[model samples]
Target chain A: MTVPISYYVVLSGLIFLIGLVGVLTRRNIIIILLSIELMLNATNINFVAFSAYLGNLSGQVFVFFALTVAAAEVAVGLAIIIALYRHTPSINVDDFRLLKW
Target chain B: MDSLIFFYFAGIILVTATLVVALRNPIYSALSLLVMFFHVAGLYVTLHAEFLAAIQIIVYAGAILVLYLFVVMLLNVKREERIHRQSLVAVLLGATLLTEAALLVFQSKGPVFPDATSSGSAGEVTGNTESIGQVLYSTYLFPFEVASLILLVAMVGAVILSKKGLLDQKS
Candidate 1:
């Protein structure tokens, strides 16, 4: 049987939901970040599949910007995480509730 | 043939991502996530998004995921199992996730996009290089340029944040 585009979409959706579950359930900040990466990759797969199935190139171009933005986001996010760790010597994200407003 | 390869990579991506989330060992999770990223890039290739597939490997698998690995190495998390022990809330949330997946599986019928396209070949259906280039250089030009500028700002912000206490410590 020839693989159809739906296969990719379903896989994307499944993986994305797993990542979402991780983000919502996991307390470890590093695991949460890894989950975020999984979510991003799921979206990337969807875009590529849709682009090819729809015979459109916009999806690939969008993927490019998404890649760039993800890179920048990770870099800045890790720096902040490091700073937070430095201040408290732990990466437990829930403990970052110093803002009680 | 094609179905086999696609499913193989799909299974790999899903399983690896699961390990990344389920493993208590943070460093192992990061490594598993890296493998997941490579599988994702393989999925992109099967879609005929050649350029995106390449970027998937270069940007995600190459750079961002590596950053994750590096941070994991640097953190040197305590080997104690006391870290983020699964709470009751987490268990409930995981049950909710399982239900959601079940719904999706039952509701979803396989292969939403039929292979029929303008080119009649699944591979050639979306060559999109020319049109994408046109839009990038025209209608979307300003946004594209603006995005680069924003990335520049973010890079600077990261560097500044990283260097904040170093100068004070030195002086």
Candidate 2:
């Protein structure tokens, strides 16, 4: 028998929680972005698992779109990082408090 | 056998995912993330999504990760000495969420989903890739085009954002 659906859900939830903690605790901007990727992948896992269990192609299609968005997000996010790094010597999140009141 | 393979992949995935977060060096973290991505693709394969597995490797591992590495090298970032000041709070929050999710999963009744093998539907007749293409090009045609548009916009934005003094010149 295939693995149970709940197992996948639990796995996804764990990954997502790890990502959340990373995003919250990490100082490096790149690592934060990587954490965001972790979160996205967790959701994608959930989508694919549901799709497979339900015997539907729509979930895979949704994943395809999610991948597309993720690619776009990475490109733009890195570009922003590059711009920010050029302006500041350090890549630490605390260094960019220009917006902070 | 199936559950064994699932556990194997799941174990590796969790470990590497933790490494991605716990590692101090950015390069080490990225490398661990790469490992996690591969195992995720393996998980997809086990779930009968061969096409997504391939796409996962090509897009996530091949493209996105290289971009991260490029920026990391370009920036030449030093290892961060301190985590966020509120890290303790973050850890507590994560622990709460994890406990809640675990309790929810364990409390659920067995086999809430339909059996894929018993259905014996169109997915079995045609290959995974073919069926996905059919649905993507037909039902998701508009969204497909929109995704391409998003890519185009992101490309342009990246180019503009990275260009020296581009925005400054305008202002």
Candidate 3:
């Protein structure tokens, strides 16, 4: 009943691709941020899978650090989004053409 | 039975992760992300990383998601942008990535599983939590402290970014 490491790798890869697609195609900034979170979680799965199979604690330890960094990223990213929203009153990525000089 | 459980958790994770990306409503997307987070924790449990599973639930599902909800509410932007057609470039890029991943999965050489000794000591340790904690304090103490510092800086940066500015005439 044990699952192989390859299955986890492939699954994480697929999920990562889906997140990439969302980041590439979606126009909403919030959704893009959510997609980024998806990608990070996918990486976490990979980390834990390897940690389990290899009988090491390093992978799980790395995941802990990744989680901490992700939390910080979300806090700062959301704040930037809110500040930008105040200026343009919009969250659409297309509307953020401030650098289109 | 274990394989079935793994599939169940994986299925839920994949589907809800897709929903998190596909759903147009930001609130709905956030909620779906919540589900994905929980299932990811389940997967961690299956992998025998109980502490990571608990942290996944507490940090991601509890704290991070709440932050997302607050942002969604604070912005209060009602009009979701129309879905943009997937451009050809994106499709090409995605397909390439998938192919590469499949190739790596199926075509790689050597043993897929590492030797048990690498992690065998982990079992001799009291539990996964204790094993991880020992390594964290001994070998990884510096990085652990650095991570805390990063969190502190991020908290300050968030406040600076979101706070009402003195430059503006109106509050």
Candidate 4:
């Protein structure tokens, strides 16, 4: 049996939801960053799937940009995580209370 | 033909992704995330995004996941830490969440993801490298350049912050 375009869309939504839950519930900073990447990848999957099914290349091009952005995000995110770890020796999200200032 | 492979890989991707987030050990979670990336790259194959697929594996699975794992190990976070909520209620809630996602995928109509644009007409489309390259270099060039600049700024800022952090601790 062949799958249609709708399947891809729904799968993208499912994966995205899973990623959202991770972002919402996880306390570890690294895990949260990973979840954010997962969310970004889910968006990329949607863009590419649409590009493929609609016979449009826009989504693929967007994926290219998204990939580059994700790389930058990880670099900066990891750097911040390292800094936090150094200060507190913990990477949990709840440990970041100094933000209220 | 493609749907079969897409479903297979998406299944693995979702499962591994769960393990990545749900697993108690940070290093194991990072490894499971690597598996998830591999499965996602497989999905890109089914989408005929060969270029994106290659980059996904090389950049994500190869470089990114390794770096994450290194950080995970480097942090030396304990395997049996009580930082994460380990209650039974949390476990049940997480399980139900996964089940809902599983049901959504199973009942959905087409491949794992679709654009859902509702384009009423049916005809040949422009889904290829040449066309994307044209649009990207032309219409999307401004945002593209801006993105690169933003990345450069972030890189420099990170280095500066880490250096400052070290300096501050020296006293």
- Residue B2 alpha-carbon offset, candidate 2, angstroms: 0.9
- Give the residue spans of candidate 1 off by over 4 A: B79-115, B118-132, B166-171
lDDT of 1 by residue, A1-101 (tens): 25666676778888898898788777778788888878887887888777777666677777777777888889888887776676667776767777667
Ranking by DockQ: 2, 3, 1, 4
By lDDT, the better pick of 1 and 3 is 3
Best by lDDT: 2
Q: Work out how many backbone clashes candidate 4 has.
A: 11
Ranking by lDDT: 2, 3, 4, 1
Task: Give the alpha carbon lDDT tens digit for every residue of A1-101 in model 2.
Answer: 46878789889988998898788788899999999999999999999988887778888899999999999999999999888777777888988988788
Give the top-scoring candidate (DockQ).
2
Kindly list the per-residue Cα lDDT of model 1 for residues B1-171, writing each as its tens digit.
Answer: 888889899889889988987888888887888788777777766766666666677877788878887887887765433335566777788789789868987897655555644434434646455666775787678879978987898899788767657434533
Residue B128's lDDT within candidate 4 is 49
Native contacts retained by model 4, as a fraction? 0.44
Any residue pairs clashing in model 2, and if so which? none
TM-score of each: 0.84, 0.93, 0.91, 0.81
RMSD of each: 3.6, 2.0, 2.6, 4.4
Whole-model lDDT, candidate 1?
0.75
Task: Report every candidate's CA lDDT.
Answer: 0.75, 0.88, 0.85, 0.76
DockQ of 2: 0.71
Q: What's the distance in Å from true for residue B126, model 2? A: 7.6
User: Which ranges in model 4 have alpha carbons more than 4 Å from their true place?
Assistant: B79-128, B164-171
lDDT of 4 by residue, A15-64 (tens): 78778878877787788888888888889888877776765667788888
